[model samples]
Target: MYKILIVEDDNTIAEEVGRYLMKWGYEVEAVTDFGDVLGHFGRFLPQLVLMDIGLPFYNGYYWCGEIRKVSQVPVIFVSSASDNMNIVMAVNMGGDDFITKPFDLEVMAAKVQAILRRTYSFSAPTSLMEYKGMILNLSDMTLVCRDEKIELSKNEYRILQTLFENTGKTVTREAIMKRLWDEECFVDDNTLTVNINRLRKKLEGLGVEELIVTKKGIGYRLGEL
Candidate 1:
């Protein structure tokens, strides 16, 4: 299912939209903290965003601009401001579409579906995985934290990719090796250990300590930052 983030401060509208979208088989999350919209965006990694202009801390346009910095994910501005100026500003700030508030839920959902289909039909959905505050950019094989980018080698990327894919579960060493093997790159025990150590050091440089925990007689699991 496609994930969507709703950045409206009004609890009622957010809940209503979230519930309506969920009924349509979409995974949705609403932002409660206005001060850290980008943080939420990084963590949720939504395929699309529904934003309201008149937020508490910073306006939706500002948040949209910030999101554009790290991601090209589609953003749809949802606001009561139907004025021409607001709409134009929304577009200039990287909004994919605009939905004026007091909107019919059906129309809102239709707009979401249309945008999602159009945005992802010809291209792959944005491949991003987030744990704690760290984001793994799967397409470019880089890890991002606090606005900094860290490049990863092929083996390093694959290792983190496997661990990120199984965040809440332990990924066995054999399973990780199999993933590498599937790519036709054989990884023995010592090589896998070296890769894991390197990955841990990289994570450490980002102030992430013990982000990867080794389970004795088992495999590795991602720990909280």
Candidate 2:
């Protein structure tokens, strides 16, 4: 089933959309934190997004811009401000389609189905992930900061990729090496440390201080500043 991430703030409408989408067999997750929209977007990794313009902290346009910075996932704007200006702004901010508030559920579903098919039919979806403000592009094997870029070696990319995917939680070193060990021969502790240090320096260049935190004797984690 296709995943649908709902960035609607209103509980009634968000849950309503969730219910409707669930009935149609699309997995759904509603946004609970207004201040950290991109965080949820990274964690959810939804195939499609339904966002409302007027929100609690930053508006939908702000969140839309943030999502656009990382992935090309289809985002359909759903808002009461369906004026010509808002519609045009949504498009300018990278929204795929617009649906005014108090919409027919069936029509919304139809638009969603059409957009997903059109967007993902001919090409495989990009698998790069983002957290906070960093983007790890799996297609090109590069990590991009606001303006700078970091090229990753195979081991460095896998290690960073695994940690990013499990950000907001502790990822054991063993887990990281198990993933690395799958692709390469017996990796020594020094080898893993070298890879992690290289990845950290690349991230440091991006202005992220201590991007990957060592959790004592446990594992590694990405923390928001």
Error of 1 at 187 (Å): 5.1
Which residue runs of candidate 1 sit more than 4 Å off their true CA positions? 1-3, 19-27, 35-45, 69-71, 81-89, 102-107, 181-188, 216-218
Measured with C-alpha atoms, the lDDT of residue 83 in candidate 2 is: 84
Best by lDDT: 1
Query: Could you tell me the TM-score of candidate 1?
Result: 0.76
Clashes per model (N, Cα, C within 3 A)? 0, 0
Per-prediction TM-score: 0.76, 0.76
**Over 4 Å off in model 2, which ranges?**
130-135, 144-155, 162-195, 211-225
* Model 2 CA lDDT for position 127: 84
Q: Kindly list the per-residue Cα lDDT of model 2 for residues 52-154, writing each as its tens digit.
A: 9999988999889887766789999999887899999999999999998899999999999999999999987778687775778787677766645678888
Q: What is the lDDT of residue 132 in candidate 2?
A: 72
